[model samples]
Target chain A: AQRVTQPEKLLSVFKGAPVELKCNYSYSGSPELFWYVQYSRQRLQLLLRHISRESIKGFTADLNKGETSFHLKKPFAQEEDSAMYYCALRASGAGSYQLTFGKGTKLSVIP
Target chain B: DTAVSQTPKYLVTQMGNDKSIKCEQNLGHDTMYWYKQDSKKFLKIMFSYNNKELIINETVPNRFSPKSPDKAHLNLHINSLELGDSAVYFCASSPMVGGGGGDMDTQYFGPGTRLTVL
Candidate 1:
């Protein structure tokens, strides 16, 4: 079965510290990976995707096919960056259009 | 200009009651989806509709049904709601199937409807 695993449930860092949210997936075929962020009292929104290879809000994620991982990273964390982050995967499995999401990681950046 | 919107931002009702949550997307996307976030904050896919046709249905209970009258609207109705149904439901949309540009996989989520069952 295809699944998305976010190992960290909570991560805390200083304002200028580097931040990394680990994500691993289990799938036979190549799947699309995405990172969604949900700020306090706000709707969940797309932060970045593997294919895009673009950074959003100072966050970037690289897809490591060999490792079967798509980890989200940010060189410098800011207080405003604190939020709940979910790792999602889309495959040709039973749920085609729907994405399988991980439990999520709560990121807190202290000033 | 909400691309994807769901009615009843918050719904509090007693168990065994019947309720419906309406969802609509103005982005003209060909696909829509419903996701449930449990109290533990674990999110799961409930259903997906493409071009007003059901394409993906998760292991959700039969008491929950999704109806898509047109490509732009998809509604979820729960018959005899249970306490387990208490969670935040999110409505989302994407471009279409087999259309890959990275953006296709990026689903836009609504504000989410928090359903509380007592």
Candidate 2:
């Protein structure tokens, strides 16, 4: 069974402050981790994936297999970054395209 | 132009009534999905279709049925709706699963429909 855990339901940070959204997972096999963001009144979009190792809109996430964590981090928080963030995991295998998502964390960046 | 779109952005209905939520994707992808987001903002996969074929079906109730008339359209119909069914329903699409190291499993989501079962 593969499960993603995002413990924080809400997180607040002052402008220009650092942001870290914690995420942990439990999976038997190797899994691909991803971070998704949903802005207000907008559709959910992919932020970054561990496989790509690329930063999007100043957000980045690294998959740590040993710790079973793929926490998302940003150097400086911005008001526009405030949105619902979800951590998802996809198991490794052929035809395993299902994405198990966490409960999600609501990040609020105060201006 | 919206890549993925769902109709009836907001719905309010009485209990026991049957309703359908329509979803269509113009991205020409081979896979489509339906997800439910509860009040707690917990998103879960309900159904998935690939090339008009039922590929993935989760532990959802029988009352919730998904239909794919074509590769681009997927509709969800709920019968004898219950109060617990009131939540936001989202439609998404993605390309087929490729070998590796590509945008194969990346899904593009629709605007989502807010269903209110009164």
Candidate 3:
């Protein structure tokens, strides 16, 4: 079965500190990975995707096939960056349009 | 303008009652989906529709039904709602590229409907 694991329920870091939110996946075939974020009182939105390999909102995630991970990282954390982040995977096969999402990790940037 | 919207931003109802949540997308996407977020904030896909056709249905209970009257609308109806059904439901839509079953498209989500069953 394909699954996305976010491991950390909450991650706290001081402002200007580096931040890393761990994400791992279990899948046999190639998977399309994505990071979605939901800020307080804001709707959920796409942050980035492995296919695009683009950084968004100062956050970058590199797909590590060897480790089967796509951890989200930022050089410096900001108070405004605090939000709920979710790792999702879409398997490559028929009837695989649906995304399997992780439990999500809440990042709290302490001022 | 709202790209994707869901009706009844908050719903508080008694158990055993039936209710419906409606979703609409003006982005002209070919696919729409329903996701449930539990109290723990764990999100899971419940159903998906492509161009008014059912494409994916997860292990949701039969009491829950998803209806796509058209490509731009998808509605979820729950029968005899249980206390366990209390959660935030989100509606999302994505454009299908290359007609490849919308595998690699970016999904836009609505504000979400918080359902509270007592």
Candidate 4:
């Protein structure tokens, strides 16, 4: 069984400060990692995927195969960045439609 | 326009009561999913349907059943709800399930329906 772990349940960062949300996964085969963000009273939306390797809204994440982690990073946190961030993993090939998600990290950007 | 949407923004029912939640996707995607977010904010997939066919069924209890009338709709029905079943249910859809690349697994989610079992 694949499991995703988000070490920080709640993370506080001052506005303009760098923010890092840690995520680690336990899987045997290769897996696809994704970062999803849910704003206040908003639906969950895809932020970025490790496979895309594209930065969105000044946020980027790199897949670390060695550490079995994919941490979301932002150079400067903004008030709009305060939301619930969830790290998700999808197994490759068959039954890959199912996404196993982390408990999620609540990011609080203090002004 | 709303890409994915679920009916009954909030549901409050007593234990042992039966309830149903409906979901629809206007994105014309082929795959739809049902996920439950518990009180601790732990999101887990309960069911997945592609073209009205059952594909991914998690270890969820039999009390939870998903019905897909067509490619764009997937409804979830709970036979006997329990307090533990109180959670936010989200509906999502993706263009394709398995293949690789080109937004293969990029999912569009609904606003979610909060179910509270008293």
In terms of DockQ, the best-performing candidate is: 4
- Model 3 residue runs over 4 Å out of place are B97-104
Error of 2 at A95 (Å): 3.0
Which run of 10 residues does model 3 chain A get worst, by summed lDDT? A90-99
lDDT by residue (B41-98, candidate 2, tens digit) is 8999999999999988999999999999999999999999999999999999988743
The predictions' CA RMSDs to the true structure, in order, are: 1.5, 1.0, 1.7, 1.0
| Residue-by-residue lDDT tens digits, candidate 3, B1-118 | 8599999999999999999999999989999999999999999999999999888899999999999999999999999999999999999999962233233478899999999999
lDDT of 1: 0.91
Pairs clashing in candidate 3?
A: none
Q: Chain A only: TM-score of every candidate?
A: 0.95, 0.98, 0.98, 0.98
For model 1, chain A alone compared with the true chain A gives a TM-score of: 0.95
Interface RMSD of 3: 3.0
Can you tell me the CAPRI class of model 1?
medium
Say what the RMSD of model 4 is: 1.0
Better of 2 and 4 by lDDT: 4
Q: Residue A71 of candidate 1: its Cα lDDT?
A: 93
* Residue pairs with clashing backbones, model 4: none
Residues A1-111, candidate 4, lDDT per residue (tens digit)? 899999999999999999999999999999999999999889999999988999999999999999999999999999999999999998997767788999999999999
Segments of candidate 1 deviating more than 4 angstroms: A92-95
User: How high is the CA lDDT of each candidate model?
Assistant: 0.91, 0.93, 0.92, 0.94
Question: Individual DockQ of the candidates?
Answer: 0.65, 0.70, 0.62, 0.79
Q: A30-93, model 1: which lDDT tens digit per residue? A: 7889999999989999998888889999999999999999999999999999999999988854
Sort order, DockQ high to low: 4, 2, 1, 3
